[model samples]
Every structure is written in structure tokens, then in C-alpha cells.
Target: MCLLAMSNSLLQSAKKVILTEAQAVMMLADGLDQSFIDACQLIQNCTGKVVLIGMGKSGHIAGKIAATFASTGTPAFAVHPGEAGHGDLGMITQEDVVIAISYSGESDEIMTLIPIIKRLGILIIGMTKNVNSSIGRISNVHLDVSVEKEACPHNLAPTSSTTVALVMGDTLAISLLINKGFSVDDFARSHPSGTLGRRLLTLVSTIMKIGDDIPIVSADTKLLDALLIMSQKTLGMVLITNNNNILKGIFTDGDLRRVLETYPNIQSLTISKVMTPNCQSISKDRPAMAAVQMMDEFNLNSLPVVDDNNQVVGAINTHTLMQAKII
Candidate 1:
């Protein structure tokens, strides 16, 4: 009974936190200002890199924002304000744009670097809640990210304010991305190690079974022989090719089942007699995601991959696509 009561209390607390965060997000959405546009314009017009600076939790969010900008076509990097006072300030050039993040706009670490940054002639964009604070007053462009209260019960932690800052940063990055005509292919190039890259950049040639691994049989081959080859390849299907090695049709598991039901004596039938004549085929250079879509639209589990001359080059199955995370 004690454990059950504890669990109930924890669940209730979690729900309250979620509701508070939702309310805070709504407040941010309602308080959009022109200062946001000014900040974006400054960054967009910057001739050099974007330098993001912040302290504590704001610093972590600023780092993520800098990474997003760099990956999405805008060249940017995060520099700790405290380190800027040492020697890291050299990373900033006169043509660069600096973005400083602080909830109260009076973080001592960030304040100490402002004069040096200004003396360097670098453009300054301030992201803060207080418009009259030191950083805001000195900045060329000020973006307001004020929040009514934090999601934290004591209102001491940077919860809602950090969320607002992150959203604002994402908005700026995406706006610049669109303005620069960043494409899906460009994103794929930036993320080559993840599932997104595999889905967008992986070609049929990379995943399809080629040469000896492909289950192929001549049109005159018996259905039983084709089934044996299909079983050996473990692809659940076999392709029917002409004497010129060109794809003519496909004999899949479904076709075998239908043939068995329609003609119980199909064991002795020729493969060409029962195969699907108008089977879907894809090019070797087609994107893996496109192949998955074609299979889904045609209600097929496998497809024959062909070359420019319509010759059967390879075959791919749903399992292969699943392993590659293309579906």
C-alpha cells in the first residue's frame, strides 16, 4: 500500500510538471516580437562565422544551437564567455556575428567579454529577457526570450526560459536554411552516419543481392526448379529472365500459392506460365527510400533491380530495406 501511494504521488507530480511546461511554451508562442527578426537579419548578413556565447545551462543550449546552425548550412561555433577573457576571443573576427544568451542579461562572465567583442568590431546579437540590461543595451540586435515563470516549482531553475531560447534558435537556423535553399540531399550529406543518411543516400546497388546471390531462372524453367532456386536464395521469390538476361517476369511466393490453389498440378507447369508479367522493377541507382515506397505502393515484398539496358542486375527484399532502415 505504501509503494502504491508513492507511485501515485510521483505520477501526479510528473503530470503537474508536464502541464506547467505546456503552459510555459504557450506563453512563449504568444510573446513573439520584432526583436527576433532583427537578430535573424544580423546573423543572415554576417560575412564571417557566428559565435555563440552563454553561461551554465544557457551555455549548453547555445552549444546545441551552434551545432544546428553549422550542420544546416550556417557556419557557427560556441565559445564559452569565461574562456573568451583568456585567449579564445581570437576565434572571433571583425566580420563575425556574436550571439550572447542569458536569462537575466546580466551574467558576469558574459558581461566581461562584451567590451572586447565590441572593440573587435564584431556584430553582437543579444538573447535575453531584460531589455534594459547591460548586454541588451550594448548589443546591435536584441532578441527577447522572456517567460512568465519557469516550469520549476520554485521558479529558480532555467526551465521555460531555456525552452524559449532553444525554440528561438531553431527558428533562426531553419529560416536561414530555407533562405539559403538547403535541401534534403544537403541534410543527408551532413548526417552520413545515421538512419536518415541511409534512407536518402543508399542506392539499390548497395543493398541488393547481385550476381550469384540473385535468384534467377530462364522462362522455360519448370516451376519446381524455380522454387528450388528461390528456396536456396532465401528471397521468397525468383526472377524469370529471357535468353538475353533481360527481366521478363517474377515468380513470387504469392504467385506460387495462387497457382497451387488454381491449378493443383502446377508442380509441372513452366515458370513463364504462372509468373507475373508486369512486375515492378527499379533501377540500380534509385534511392533506397524510393524502392521502399514502390514496394509499399505495389503491395510487394521484393523487387527486381535492373540496369539501364533492362537487364536483371540484382534483387532486393523488404528484409534488406528493414535492416538498412530505409522503411
Candidate 2:
């Protein structure tokens, strides 16, 4: 019974923390004003990269914000305030825009580099709770990221404050992303290894089986002979084409199962007699993801790749999409 009580108490604490942080984020959203707009303008008009700087826990949030900006179209990177005081300050150029995050708005390390940043004529955008604080006062634009209280039971620990700062960073990045008319293709280019990149950038032609790898048989070929090719190709389907390689029909394992129940002597039958005529086919120029969607929509496991004139070029199956990580 005591164990159950402890478990309930732990859950209550977790729920309370989540609710408190959520409410703080809502308050931050309601408080958005021209300062947010001015900071965004400073970043959008900058000729160089966006530099993010913070101390301690704020530094961790700064790194994440920098990554979000870089992935979404803006060029940005995080620099530790302590490091900037040492020689990393050189990383910031006059064309670059600096976004300094200090919840207290008085990080000594960041303050130490302010004069040098100013001397370089770089623009500063500060994110903090107090506009009158030292870092905020020096900023060209000050974004208020204040919260009523921390979610921590002791009213300390950077809980709600950090969440508000992170959300503000996201708000800034997405706003800039929309303002610049960034497209999915652009985001994919920045993330070539991600699932979105694979779906958008990978072409069917690149992953489809070509040449002799495709299980192709003539219309006149025996059904058993086509089965041998299907086994060798391991694509679970075979394409029936004419002498000119123009696709005439397709035969899948499902067709073979139905054929077995209908025909007593399937070995002597021609593939054209049992093949699915006018079956769905994809163009080589289409995205690989399009092929996956077509397969799902038609309840198919494999699809043939053809050219503009419907001449067979390649083939793909569930295995192909799986190997390419498009599914």
C-alpha cells in the first residue's frame, strides 16, 4: 500500500510539472509583440549566419535552437559564452546576427564579449525576462521570454523558463522559415539522411531494379518458366512484355495462387493467359515514395517502372522500398 501511494505521488508530481510548463508556454505566446518581429527582421536581413550564445542550461537550449534554424533554412550555430570570451568570438562576423540567451539577462561571460561584438558592428538580439537587464539593454532587439514561475517544486530549477525560451526559439525559426518561402525540398537538402529527405529526394529510377535484374518474360513464355524467373529475381512478380520490351501485362504470386485453384495443368499454360493485363505501373521519374503510396493504394506488393511510352525500364517491390528506407 505504501508503494502504491509513492507511485501515485510520483505520477502527480510529473503531471503537475507538465501542466505548469504548458501554462507558462501559453503565457509566453500571449506576450508576443513587436520585439519578436524586430528580432526576426534583424535575422532575416542579415548577410551572414545566425550565432546563438548562452550560459549553462541556457547554453544547451541555445544549441538546440541553432540546430533547428540550420535544418529549417537559416544558417546558424551555437557558441558558448565562455568560449567566445577566449578566441571563439572571432567566429562572429559583422554580417552575422547574434542571439544571446540569458534568463537572468546578466551572464558575465556573455557581457564580457558584448563590447567586442559591438565593436564589430554585429547586431544583438537578446532573449530574457528583463528588458532592463545588462544583456537586454545592449541588445538591438529584446524578446521577453518571462514566465510566472518555474515548474520545480522549490520554484527554482530552470523548468518553465527553459521551456518558454525553447518555444520562443522555435517560434522565431518557423516564422523565418515561412517568411523565406522555404520548401520541403529545401529542408530535405539540409537533412539528406533523415526519413523526410529519403522520401522527397529519392527517385524511383535510382532504386528500381534494372536490366536483367527485372523479372521479364515474353507473353508466350510458359507460366512455369515465368515462375522460375520470378524465383531468380526474388521480386515476387514478373512482367510480360513484347519483343520491343513494351509491357503487356504483369503476373504476381497472388495470381499464381488463384491460377493453381483454377487450372489443373498450369505448366503448359502461356503467361499471357493468366497475367493481369493493364496493371498499374509507375514512371521512373517519380519519387520513390510515390511508388510506395501507389502500392498501398492498390494493395500491391510490387510495381513495374516504365518510360513515357510505357516501355519497361525497371521494377520495384516491397523489398526495394524497405531497402531504401522509404517506408
Candidate 3:
């Protein structure tokens, strides 16, 4: 075949797969009912985590679903059905809820473990394409993830079915997340090193440049001296303050540029003469994200941090926020 023809075939195949999977997800959404609500309530009422079990491709989907549940305020983890025969069933108990995943709802290994879970008096939630299959018959709640066809051209692979299963799992997890009122801070706690955690949990004092690195100068300091300090600190701005360390105004590189353009003798100017008064400042205890918002609102790159007395204690800029991953 020619290159153009082969490329056309590949593109068409990809588009068909996407369209099939999209249909599958829509069907899964439409099929949600009181059973889904009951499943969510069962998982929510469990004192322990949701122990998911499956075989083969369903096992892969089950693992991902377990991870989604765990990250979204619903505690869950996946266990292999075959492994349950090898004594992994001990991981589950009456306080936990078991979520069994199987397209046909008749995976032999899963069926074998169903009795064991039932013996423990554990509630079982079945996710499958067949509502009349063995797992569905025994489960306390049955969620239908059925799809009309597979995305695979041969209709033999677990393609559209898996997509539907994942979406259904997401629906359950997110519903529980909303019911529990999970906040950004709670999510951030689970991922302290991620950008969201840095934005939501990082405090201004943690990232603000402190000590002598802060660009500070007296209001009476000459423009040449202030410029030297700003350059030495490499902050592109200087805090113009009185001898008592109380902030009088702020003089940035932009302020210096304007002064240089407006005045004939830049060297003769004092920082107070060209500084911007009543500049926006934040307290040390505020979240670093708040500073990002201020900078965005005022089109500023730096902000002075002050104590209760309005004394400049530290300074932060866009670069600092970036370093902290707060932007």
C-alpha cells in the first residue's frame, strides 16, 4: 500500500476507536440509577477501604479504579482474584466493601472468591456488562458498564468496555468526593510535592527571600545607591523605608525607568522622591498562592512582606513564586 493510503487507514481506525469509546462512556452515564447511589452509600458507610478484585483486563481497570477512589477521599485498593485463593483474601473484612469487576460477571477466580467474601459478611458491589451473571446475582449492588460493541475492529479486545468501566468508576469516586466535601487542601495533603500542594499549602514565609538578601533602602537614599542595592540583591525592586524599618514606599525597575525618562539628572533623585506610596503588601502567614493572585491582579512581579507594624521583613517576586511552584 502507498504511504498516503496506510496513513488514511490508521487515522480512520483511531477515529473509530475514539467514537466507539465515547459512545460507551455516554451509555455508562445514562445507565446510572439508584443502584449507583446504593453502591456509593455502601462504600461510604464501610469502616474500612474498598477492596477491589478482578481478573485479566478487568483487573487492570480495577487497579486504576482503586487508585481513583483512594486519591479522591474514598479509600480503596485492588486485590487480584487469583491471589485471593493464595490467601490474599485476608486483606478484606466485614468492615470493608468488595468491588468485583468482570465484563461477563463470571470470571472463575472472582466467582471462587465471592463465597469467601460473603462468608465474611462483606458487602459486594459488582461492576460488569452482564446484569444476570453470577457476580451480579450475588452482589448487594450491581453497576452496569455494558457497551454495544468493542472499539477493536474484531470486537474481541476489551476496548470500549474498559473505557465505560473507568468512567463509571470515576462517577462513583467523584460522587463520594462531593458528598464528603473534599477540599483542595485535603487533596493537597495527599500530594505535598505536587504543584497543587505547593500552591495551596505553601505559606509566604516559607518561600519569601529573607535576611540581607531582601532589597531594602532608606527613603532618603540616593537613586544611585538604591539602584546599587537593587542590582546587588538582583530582585529588580527595592523597598523604600524609614530608619525605623517601616515601609514608606516601593521603587521598582519600572519606577526607575519612568524617573530616568522624566528627570534630567537621575543621580540627584532620592528613592522617596520617585517611589510608589502605599504599595500592596502581604503578611507572612498568608498562603503563597495569595501573593500570586495579587501579582496577577496588579501586574506586579514582586511584593513586600511586612509584620503587624508595617515593617518590611521579607520580599517575594514572580521568580520566588515559580521556584516554590505556586504560580
Candidate 4:
């Protein structure tokens, strides 16, 4: 073939691969039935974690499914089927649910261990192309991930089938996550080291400066004294509170610059005269992400964290959040 023909053929093959996978997903959605609901209920009510098992390409998809399940609130892990015969079956319990994936639904490695898993009285959720396959016939719930054709021209490779199985796994995990009322905080707790986890799980108190480090001054104080406090704290802002520790206003460097430009008698003014009244504040218990959002919307560099009684408890700045990798 000419080089031009080869390139055209390659592009057509890529397009076919994408379309086949996309169509498989759509067909899987159309075929979703009560079995999908049953599968979700089993996972939601399981007292223990989900155990996923499969072979070859199915095993790879099972691993991804296990990860999605674990991160979404359903504690789950993947175990290879061949390894199950070698004693990994002990990892499952009667209170847990077992999900097995196989394109043919009767991979010998998977079939050989089905009896042992069933003997444990563990509920089985089978994902396969044939609902009548050995694993499916015995499963408490069966998800048919059948595809009409593989993306491979020879129809030998696991292409559309694996893609559909993966989509089905995601469907199960996300549905279970929703049924369990799993919130962003719950997901973050499960993945505390990742970026999304850091943003959602990191608390304001974790990054906020407390005790003597908080830049605070009385409303009756002089502007020069407040600026000194701001300089000492280096947070670019001074919190103005009442003698009783009630936050009243805040005067930031922005406010100072504005005052300097808008007023001629800067040296004679009190802090309250130049302060921004009733400035926005956040709760110390709130997530750091919330603070970042507030700062972005208001173009602020810092905010005072208040308690239920509206008393300043701590102070957080953009720099601190950035340093903590929570922004």
C-alpha cells in the first residue's frame, strides 16, 4: 500500500475503535435492568469490603473497578482468580460481596474458583457477555456487558468488551456511592494524599495561624499600630476586633493603599476609620477549599476564621494554603 493509503487506513481504524467502544457503552446503558439495582443493593448493604476477581484483560478492568469502588466510599480490593486457587480465597467473607468479571463468563481460572467463593456464602456479582454462562447462572446478580463485535478486525482482542465492562464497573461504583450518601469529604478521606483529597479534606485549622501569630488589633488602635501588626504578621492584613474579642472589621494592605490615595490625613485616623466594616470571615472547621473559593471570588489574600459565637479563633492566608498544598 502507498504511504497515503496506510495513513488513511490507520485513521479509519482509530475511528472505528472509538465508535465501537462508544456504541458498546450506549448498548450497555440500554440493557441495564433490575439486576443492576440488585447489584447496587448488595454492595450498599455489604458489611465488609467488595472483592473483585477476574483473569487477563478482565483482571485489569477489575483492578480499576476496585480502585473506583474504594475511592467512592465502597471499600473494595481486587484479587486475581488464579491466585485464589493458591489460597487468596480466604480474603473473602460471608458478609462481603464478590464481583467477578469475564468477557466469556467462563474463563477456566475464574470458573475453577467459583465454588470456593460460593461455599463461603459470599454474594456474587458477575459481569460478563453471556447471562447464561456458568458464573452468571449462579450469581446473585448478573450484569451483561455483551458487545456485538470487538474493535479488532479479527474480533479476537478484548476491545469493546473490556470497555463496556469498565463502564459497567464505574456505573456500579458511582451508584453505590450515591446510595450511601457519600460526600466529597468522604471521598477525600479515602484519598487524603491526592489533589482532590487535599482540597476537600484539608481543614482551615490545619493551615490557619493561631495564638500570638494572628494579626489582631482593636478598632480604637491607630492606623500606624495596625500597619505594624500587619508587617509583623506578614499576612498583609490586620484583624480589628473589640476588646471582648468580637471581630468588627478588617484593614488590609489594599485598604491602606486606598486610604493613602483617598485620604490626605492618614496619620491622624483611627484603625476603624480606615478599616473595611463587616468583612467576610470563614469558620475554622470549614475546608481549605472553601477558603480558596472565597478568596478567589473576593480577590482576598487572607481571611479571619471565626467560631459559632463569631469570635476570631484563627487566621488563614493564601500563602499558608499554598504551602500546605491545600489550595
Candidate 5:
């Protein structure tokens, strides 16, 4: 009975904390106004990077906000207010915009660098509870991230306030992302090691099988010979081309099944008689993701990679895409 009561009490406390933080986020959303717009425009117009600064708990949130901004097409980085006072202040330039995060609006370390930042004529965007606070009063634009109360029972820890500030930072970064018309391809270029990067940046030429690796048979080849080549290639399909390597058609396992059922004497038939003529092919220069889409839309297991003159240069299949993780 004692343990049960303690568990219930802990659950109630956890529930209260989540509800309080959620309400704080809703309040932040409802309070959005022109200050948000002004700050976004200021950062967008900046020719140099965005410099984020804060102290203590706000400093941690500032680093996360900086990372979010940098990944989402905005050039941004965080500078510890304490470190900035030492020498990191030199990183900021006249063309850069500084976003200062301090829930109380008066961090001594952050305040110390305000004079130097102002001297360089760099714009300052302040996020705080009150517009009239020290940091707010000196800021070119002030974003109010005030919350009704912290989720902490004593209202001492930086719980709700920090959540609100991080949300505000995300809102700003995403708004800039859309306003600048940043694309998935552009985002992929910045993150080459991520999954999206591999899908978008990987060209079909890099993944497609070339030369003997591609299962190819001349149009005059018998259906039995084509099946042998497909079995050896293990790509589930074979490409049919002319003597000059000009693509003519494609023969897949599915086509083989249908041909077996339709023709009683399949051994005597040429590959051209049962193969899919004028098959949908892709250029090797296209992104591998495009090949995935094309194969999915056409219900194709493999595709012939053609050159400018419709000559077979390579071949790609669902298996290759899966190997490359482009699927």
C-alpha cells in the first residue's frame, strides 16, 4: 500500500510537469506577433552568419537552436557568452546578426559583450520575459518568450521557459527555411552522410551495373538464352539490345512467367517476341531516387540505362536500389 501511493504521487508529478510545459508552448504560439517577423527578416537579410549567445541554461538551448538553424539552410552558430567575452566576440562581424537568449534578460556575461557588438553596428535580437529588460531594451528586435510558470513545483528550474525559447528558435528557423525556398536537394548537399543525402545525391550512374554486370542479350537471342543470362546476372531481368548496343526491349521474371503460360513452345521464340518493347528507360545521370519512383509507378523490376541515342549503357533494378539504400 505504501509503494502504490508513492508510485501514484510520482505519476501525478510527471503528468503535471508535462501539462505545464505544453501549456507554456501554447501560450508562446498565441503570443506570436510582428517581433517574430522582424527578427526573421533581419536574419534573412544578413549577408554573414547568425551568431547565437546565451548563459547557463539558456546557453544550452542556444546551442541547439544554432544547430537547427545551420542544418535547415541558415548559416548560424552559437557562441558562449562567457567565451565571447574572452576572444570569441571577434567571430561576429558587422554583417552578422546576434540572437541573444536569456530568460531573465540580464546575463552579466552576455551584457558585457553588448557594447562591443553595438560598437561594430551588429544587430541584436533578444529573447526574454520582458521587453523593458536590460537585454531587451538594447535589442533591435525583442522576442517575448515568457511563460506563466515553470513546471518545477517551486518554479525555480528553467523548464517551461527553456521549452518556450527552443520552440521560438525552431519557429524562426523553419520560417526562414520556407521564405528562402530551400529545397530537399539543397538540404541533402549539406548532409551527405545522411539517408536523404544518399537518396538525393546518388546518381543512377554510380549504382547501375555496367558492362558484363548488366544482363544483356541481343534481340535475336532465344527466350531460353535470355533466361540463362537473367539467372546469371541475378538482377531479376535482362536487357535486349541490337548489335550496336541500341536498346530494344526488357525481359523480366514476370514476363518469363507470362510467356511460359502463353506459349507452349517458348524455346523456339525470339526474345523480341515476348519482351516489353519500347520499355521505360532512365538516363544514368538521373538521381537513383528517380529510378525508384519510375520503377514503382510502372511496376517494373528493372530498368535499362540509356544514353542520348537510346543505346544501352547500363542497367538498374530494385535490388540495386535496395543495396544502395535509395529505396
Candidate 6:
């Protein structure tokens, strides 16, 4: 019982920490100033890559900022200040822009590399809480990421300060993305193995059922025959086509159930008499993510895939999209 009580108490404390950090973030809107605009302009005008450097928790945030920039159409990499003094400083080119992160702007490891970075003719953008500190005074552009207080109960850990710094870094990356005219497709390309990429890059033709797997019936076919085709093809619906193989209508399991409710003898009724005409259909070349959006917009479980000529070439179900991770 004592151990369980201790665990519960720790969880409650953690929740309070997170809530305090959130409150600190909500207060950041008032701190936006001209310095923020200067930082953004410096990064936007940079012709070379952005080199991020920091120590400890700042280093972790710098690494994430580098990744965000790279994924958002900016070339960037994180270099450790300690590593820079050893051999990693070679990664810095004269055309690059260095972004140094230091909460107090007094980290000796970071300060030691500033002269070398400056001597190489690279521009420096400093992120710090103290705008009057050495790093801020020496940098070409200084971004203030000061916070009211740390979320840490002891007021010693880097909590709210790191959050503010990360937010500032994200703001810079997003602003550059807009200035560069980056699109969702470009982001998807950068994250091809991620969920966003699967949603945006996967085409309808990649997931739709084709050839004999497609359940198709003539517009004049009997309802019973369509049901057999749907069962044989194992797709819950059957596409109705005319003599030219153009899609005319669709009969799904829901339609069958509704018709059976009214007719009670739907098996004897013709497909044309009960089929839903002018039903929604997707193009084969359309993005699977677009199809998912359409399905959600129309509240459908299955959709017919058609070509430019309005011919039913395939069919796709919600399960197929789920398997492709398009949801």
C-alpha cells in the first residue's frame, strides 16, 4: 500500500510539472520582439546550411531544431560544442550560419568555439535567456528565449527555458518554410517512411482492387447475380457498368440491407431498379490520402475507382486504406 501511494504521488507531481510548463508556454506571446524578426531574417537570407551548436539540454533541443529545419526545406546539422573544439569544427564552412544555444549564454565549451566560428567568416545566431550576456553581445543576431521561471520545483532544472527555446527554433523553421514556399508534398517527401508520407504519397491505384478481384456487374444484371458477384469477389460491393464498361451505379451491403427491408424480395429485383445512381467515385491517380478524406467526408466504407474516361477499373475499401496506413 505504501509503494502504491508513493507511485501515485510521483505521478501527480509529474502532472503538475507538465501543467506549469504549459502555462509558461502560454505566456510566450508577449515576449515576441524585433530580435525574433532579426533571427528569422538572418536564417532566411542564409545561402549555406545552418549549423546548430549547444551543450547538455540545449544540445538536445538544437538537434531537434536541426532536424526540423532539414525536413522543412532548409539544410541544417547539429554540431556539439565540445566536439567542435576537437575535430567536428571542420564541418563548419565559411558559407554556413551557426546557431549557438545557451540558456545563460555562459557555457565555456560553447564560448570557446565562437572565435573559431567567427574567424571562418560564418554568421552566428545566438539563442539565450540573457540578451546582455557575452554570447548575445557577440552574435550577429540574438534571439531571446527567456522564461519567467523553471517548471522544476527547485527552480534549477532547465524546463520552461528549454520549452521557450524549442518554440523559438520551431518558429524560425516554419517561417523559413513559408518563405521558401515549401508544401505538404515536400514535407511528405522528407518523411516518406512516416504516417504523413503514407497518407500523402500512396496513390489510389496502389491500393485499389483490379482485374478479377473487382466485383463488376452489368446495369441490367439481376440483384441476385450482383450479390453472387459481390460474394465471389469478396469485396462487400459490386460496380454496375453499361455496355461500354462505364460505371453507372454501385450496390453495397448497406444498400442491399435497406432494399431488403422494403422489398423483402430484393433477390428477385433488378439492380437498375434499386441501385444508387451517380454515386461518388475516386480517380485511380488520386492520392490515397485524398480518398481517405473523401471517404470521411462522405461517410463511406468503400469507393469505386474510375479512370479519366469514367470506366470502373478497380475498387477500394476502408480495410485496404487502413492496411496501407492511409488513415
Tell me each candidate's TM-score.
Answer: 0.90, 0.88, 0.91, 0.88, 0.88, 0.94
Model 1 per-residue lDDT tens digits across residues 276-317: 996899999988888988998999999999988889999999
The sequence of per-residue lDDT tens digits that candidate 3 reaches over residues 56-117 is 99899999999989988888999998888998888887899999999999999999888778
Pairs of residues clashing in candidate 2 = none
| Number of the predicted model whose TM-score against the real structure is largest | 6
Better structure of 1 and 2 per TM-score: 1
Residue 115 CA displacement from its true place in model 4, Å: 2.8
Candidate lDDT values, in order: 0.89, 0.94, 0.90, 0.90, 0.93, 0.89
Best by lDDT: 2
* RMSD, candidate 3, Å: 2.2
Candidate achieving higher TM-score, 3 or 6: 6
Global local distance difference test of model 1 = 0.89
Candidate 5 vs candidate 6: which has greater TM-score?
6
Worst 10 residues of 1 by lDDT: 20-29
lDDT pick, better of 2 and 4: 2
Candidate 6 residues lying further than 4 Å off, grouped into runs, are: 1-12
TM-score result, candidate 2: 0.88
